[model samples]
Target: MWLGSEFCARHILRHCDTLAGLPAFWTREQHGEEASTWLLFTHKYDYLKHLADRYRSRAEPMTRTFSITETAITTSPPRERVLLLLAVALMESFGIQVNLCLDPAYRQLEGFVLDRQRCAIIANWVDIDAVWHVDVNTNKPDLQRYADALDHAQARSAIAAKTPTGRLTALAGLLDLDWQWLTHRCGELAAYGSAGIADPHSRLLSTAGVDRACGYVATVATHNG
Candidate 1:
């Protein structure tokens, strides 16, 4: 049950009275439903938007091109990691139980907001990607395929790590300069998962699919300004 920012915002405005009160309400509400996920997402977006505004105010002016690379993302003083950690902290402040999953490829780290009361996975950061539901009711064939591919890739990389030659090959593949290939493959998978669900909300969600949709908006504003 993936939801876009607008849908989340609208739902929150209709159902929730205050952002601070959301966690309690969501905890008491039913899990694994689209409405519940939307409420959670609404809070997530609100927190991210506030964080982006704070970052924009404190950010130093610079003209250098912002590059997104595995090394740039996972190494010490990583920008994405820092921002995501901040997001996790903020969610915790609101009483939301969130978890982070670091991809084996180290390309990206995903955050999942859990329904602690039900011990269920509710919503995840599906930024610029398809939102996945790990519940029994929803069909996630495309997500499963993508997960299988990722597992296979990780398994191969693990085997390749035993030898110097194999290590070099694995490193080359991981650090492959062609990020377009990776992004394209992810877009294809998202498209497949979202097939036949092309409503306006879905389109907005896809466009804003990165970990924090607000962060992407903030980045563009910073660059353009």
Candidate 2:
């Protein structure tokens, strides 16, 4: 994984609507060149000239609104530039920031940002299939709790349509509530089944309850006598 830069970050945000629903990763060199060529080949001079004009017109308004000094515009350091570009790229394309650092084993140098805060200390070395096990150390609070949190969150999401029905004798009053009220209180529960809240089994189902969509197959080997 590559570190993000603000320039690229802004560019990404600018074009994000064009690039959503893509796979998680992209070929950097290819993408960069392609983007550059796309900008150049499609009425090249007119595009850049228009960009320059727009930039100039917006510069004063941006400075006035943000109170940025001229020095801030003229002398940005290299790391800052890279971070700026990457951030712009991320913001445009993914609407997020870079906060996570990939575990060293992948040998790819991309940084990660869990849910988009700027804490970049934690790293996960596990394979992608086992990604759910990645933990957030104390240094990385934004991501420290996500591993299990994601699982539980997903579990709760899955079970939203199902009901818990071991026994209701202890609270018959609660259990015997009107169907219309329950349905009105919880509408998301309707997606999974027909009976919904009226059914005896209206508690949320587990991840196991949700059917896998695609490419999730696995196999095990057996030795027989």
TM-score of each: 0.26, 0.16
- Model 2, residue 130: distance off in Å is 30
List the lowest-lDDT window of 10 residues for candidate 2: 212-221
Best by TM-score: 1
Tens digit of lDDT per residue, candidate 2, span 4-55?
2222333433443332222122111112222232212223223223333444
Report residue 84 deviation for candidate 1 (angstroms): 1.7
- Per-residue lDDT for 92 in model 2? 21
Model 1 agreement with the true structure over 40-126: per-residue lDDT tens digits? 344445644443443344333111001123333345232333333223323333323332112344233222221112221233323
> Residue 110 deviation, candidate 1, in Å?
10
Note the clash tally of each candidate: 4, 42
User: Given candidate 1, what's the lDDT at residue 115?
Assistant: 19
Best by lDDT: 1
What's the lDDT for all of these models?
A: 0.30, 0.24
Candidate 2, lDDT over the whole model:
0.24
